[model samples]
Target: MAIIKLSAIERRRLSAFITCLVVAILAWVFTALSNPYKFTVKQIISFKNAPQKRAFHPLQSDTVNTIVQGSGWQMLFSRMNDDKKVIEVDLHTLENRNYVVLSSQLKQINFKKQINNEIIAVNPDTLFFDFSSRRVKKVPVKLITLLKYQKQFAQSAPVSIKPAFVTISGPAEILSKIDSWETDSVVLNGLNESYNARVKLRPSTEGNLEVLPKSVMVNIPVDEFTEKTLEIPVKLINNHNYYDVKIFPQKVKVTFTTSLTKYPDTNEDVFEAVADLDKWKLGGYSVLPVKLTHIPSYSKIVKVEPRNIDFIVKK
Candidate 1:
């Protein structure tokens, strides 16, 4: 390789020429970007004011390419952005026809946009839909929850959902299979107190299905749970002959967990322990198993003492 050394004066002249060239390139780019240009971008299509007499299912994907006329800077920035752009299409015309001309609604869609770019056209120009018999039905809302409770805390009562039922309108064939709709999962962690809030329902997976009153109010009762034990008398059931039966243990200790608020009200009266005498006569079993026949549904049984009792029958 050969090296060519230049004088100080020559080096300065070369540097000045390179700086001028860079400046010229930047100026040209700025001028070009200021000019008007047209470009295409894909946006999601959402419908509003759907026809009440008929249901519609779109034949194409929800995405549509929009041809936009704007400045070169707008086109450059729009292409660089990754956010989902949604265009709302009015379906009022569907009451008379099965297709919608996108060009006719460009003014409305553009008015909702924040940018100054003009939507020139929508690819496919027209949106086609299949009509079906419209059906309206009321279905129960099932709450989906992902809950974590603090130590020694639990749900004290049933979860309450205001307006337990929601009105749904969609195609008859599709709505027939849907008996219930679920809300978006309500996630709460380390909860120690009662919770009340409004949650959004899960969006419809199908394009034609619609749910009214998109959200519902939810209430969850929370409390600290404590253990309680009671001695419950054991009663014999299926004593057809009214046999004189004496059990080794007359009573069994029932240990359960209940909310602190109901601790005082929970007692032996709320529980019933019974031994089936039919075990000896029908099953020929020597011992009878003690079973809690009646107990509060909310109570969680911990342990039952004397699970099996020895019995003597007087012939």
Candidate 2:
């Protein structure tokens, strides 16, 4: 490598040339920025104050093209700013007209006062909407949950929602079809104990439909269960007494699995075992199965031991 050194006078001249070039460019930009220019930008329109008991469908465009006229600096600053310019349009401030004319309704620009500019025009200048008259209706809230539990553990009681019902407001046609509101589906696995969670309700797909309070608390009662055994006496029914008959075993054992909370309350009074006397005859060498009667649907019956017993008859 070769080393080259510059004289002090030469270095000064080079520095001066570069400085002048920079200043000239700056002066040109200042003049250009001072001139008036026209530019287009997007303005957000937020709707407000809709009619009571009515819903407005979504608009095709969420924003409007606004043409602004101002100095280059002002227009450039306005476009460069990241803040969303909100143009609030009150729907209630309309006549019998079915459509909204933005240009006429929102003539003034609602931007920062620091930016001195004029909104020359708004593209499309008008917005068309379909309004539906809605009525309030109370509908039940249904819980949606897919749950799995550890072995020997299960849901002991019915799942409940905090708010039994919710208010839905929508078009009469849509509301008439809805009888209940359902929560979003939630899957939880390996749950060994009680489970509680707040789940969000599913949103309606209809653009004009609305649901209040969007979410509710779900209470799922769970408990551990144990096996229980009880003996139920067998009774003979529809007997004519013309022939004497006897069942070999007079009692039947009923086994079941139930939650611990209900285990102490379990009793044989709710179960019945019966064998019809009229269905048999003398010298009949056949077994009669005991029929279980009045069994509670909630308890899981494990087994009905000795379902049938040999019967002896004398004529």
Candidate 3:
């Protein structure tokens, strides 16, 4: 090989060229990263360290204009993942206005590690809440059920819930208004046997409230029913001594359907048929309808024979 060595000046010139190229590359990269960009991203705001007595509502502040700032590349990558990450907002540090200023704590937050880019602005800037100390109350749970059983079968017992009452915690005003909670409507058709179900409790109130146990176990007893008939004597009520009243066919037949188990114990004494004297008019054709009273709650009145009786009034 021919002996060839670059002069010191030539080496210096090559070094400078290399340094300039490196600087230009760095400047280009910096320019690309320094440009400001905006992206709309969803972020979960969690409340932490709240007062033990007061239960805060709305774990997330709100989905408002949440704009994050970063380079074009950072924003592009951030938008790729649709799922949002959560951030904590300390409730203990809330101000007198009960507003949690989210952006104020962003500097101290380890946001860089959590997200792909830095957040420029969290819209709504502040979260306002109507916080109230929770007061727990045990209220009865009513059932909302639609049952259509097979022919001759009906509900034998009252609608039963495992936890007849639920524990609810909310503002004093809301809690005071809630005397009971109700389960979601459960429709059961062609039901022949006893049934059990796990039903969710209906939203008791429209406001912010927390239920300890959201669901309840429901049990409904069902049984076959039998048809029964009873003959009840018709009686006149509030009669004046001035006129005497008499009704043709003094007795009426009351037919009902009752649970098979109760068919034996059911009797005529459970019902009464009466006609009001106030309806009586002298020398006028009066057809008074026989009204049955004291019917048992379990038995359903099918019909009353001799519903209207011909009555004669005398002075």
> lDDT per model, in order?
0.92, 0.78, 0.76
Candidate 2, residues 245-274: lDDT per residue as tens digits?
777788889988888988888788888889
Worst 10 residues of 2 by lDDT: 106-115
Name the weakest run of 10 consecutive residues (lDDT summed) in model 3. Answer: 55-64
What is the TM-score ranking, best to worst? Answer: 1, 3, 2
- Residue 71, model 2: lDDT of 94
Cα lDDT of model 3 by residue, 1-315, tens digit: 897788999999999999999999999987886687877877766555655566455544346456777677776666687777666666665435466787887774445444646666777778777777678899898898888999999888777788888898877877888888888998999999989889998864333466758999989888888888989999888676756777888999988999888889888888889987776654343688789878877678898897889888777
Candidate 1 stretches with Cα past 4 Å from truth are 1-18, 114-116, 205-208, 281-284
- Which of the two candidates, 2 or 3, achieves a greater TM-score against the reference? 3
Comparing 2 with 3 on lDDT, the higher-scoring candidate is 2
Estimate candidate 3's alpha-carbon lDDT, on a 0 to 1 scale: 0.76
lDDT of 2: 0.78
Answer with 1 or 3, whichever has the higher lDDT: 1
Name the candidate that leads on TM-score: 1
lDDT of 1 at 115: 67
